[model samples]
Target: MINMHYTACSLLKITFKSLLTFFAREEREDTMPNTEPKLYKLQKKDLVACILRVFAKLVLFSFHRITMEGLEHLPKEGPALLLPKHCTYGRDVALEAIALHRATGRYANFLMRAIASRFYEWAGGIKIARPKDVRRVPGARALNRASFEYIRWLYLQGEVLVAHPEGTRNPYDMGALKMGVIKHLMDVENEAGRCIPLVPIGIRYRGYWVPFSRIEVKIGEPVYADDFENIKHLLSYLREQISQLSGWVI
Candidate 1:
């Protein structure tokens, strides 16, 4: 619920401005080792960086005729959070982000795993340590902490973060959400100086993993920081909204 389509004329005046000022705000994480990846640290996204975001959005729009819903419900300015169901089979994360920016002019900062180089930098990408097993990846513990710290920083800075609460993509399953997401919202609000808005998003595609297929992006009404007292309530509401949005019932 709480969605609409913007007209062509409006996009010309509002799109660029929204994208320009978006994610151009604050974030600060605890002290970390210099050896940790840059993703763990909070760095300002400059004007040039935002400009690149514009271009990136355009490319995504041109790539597919994505259908976006409920964009207007998102805050026009300042910080917000989106927990989008991840659809790895359909490239939902990238495609939805692109569609979201095209429709609403809002961009999401993400926690990315460190590679030699990556494509996520366009969206204020932060390098993180991702290890399914601690034995498999060196320095994963500290790096994971750093990534969480930076995520908290992004929320504090007034940037909307797009995250997969399930922590991984399972296109057909909307499993248990990560407890960290719940705790993050509760723990960081006091330091943020404001209660951040937490929104739920759902992405559905015409055909799973089909090339050039039509996709629908559903953005549900926000669940604000103070709306519920604990994680269970927030979690239940989020799952319900996403289930309705994506039609992925558990």
Candidate 2:
């Protein structure tokens, strides 16, 4: 019913990710004595993320022809925000994660759905409530505030953060950009008087979900809040840049 090679690859992938989670637990134990809140305690080095990056890189390399440009734009240190094109269902997430990690030598923090938070929190994921959750789920607003606080701490710590403006996977066409995270970042900047770079990362796949296909990622120069007159202009510029880089329009 299943091909042996496919099964083997699947198992290997699972093992690698599991190993990363295990190390995350170990790292947690070694951190400064838990006075800080659970999610905000920063490890000196994200060992789990480093290993996962290498593992993901190897796995991706074995299956795809990957190329990246404008890596120079990725900040060596952070307080950096990245907005990348969401292409494939799941593979693009791995591709972008590994690509950014290997290029910048830093693990990126991501804003993810509240439902998947526990599974990915150990690996730099910050859970944020989705729109539907806000309308229907109890305490969703409080959850959002907590998550935003964590994200603010991450920024203060100079951690790289990635949030897809499109909000969800859009195969080959760009979709409407969401402002939730961006607005939060703008607030953080205004309050803290800190200017963080907003880097647009565009990922294009030659064939969607096709093994051995070519993947091209273009990282554009970082844009800062000072560069835009207003949030509306900034959003429009980001959309334009991402679309141009990903070879997708609208």
Best lDDT goes to which candidate? 2
Candidate 2 TM-score, true structure as reference: 0.85
Off by over 4 Å in 1: 1-65, 114-119, 134-136, 209-212
Which window of 10 residues has the lowest lDDT sum in candidate 1? 1-10
TM-scores of the candidates in the order shown: 0.71, 0.85
**Model 2 lDDT-worst window of ten:** 27-36
In terms of lDDT, model 1 sits at: 0.62
Best prediction by TM-score: 2
Error of 1 at 116 (Å): 7.1
- What lDDT is reached at residue 169 by model 1? 75
**lDDT by residue (tens digit), candidate 2, 1-250:** 1244355458656765576466544322311121223556863347656655666677667767889998888888859899999875446667677777667767788776765423366667676777876787777777787778888888888888888899888885898789888888889888888999999989998864456778899999999978889888999999999999999866
Root-mean-square deviation of every model? 9.3, 5.0
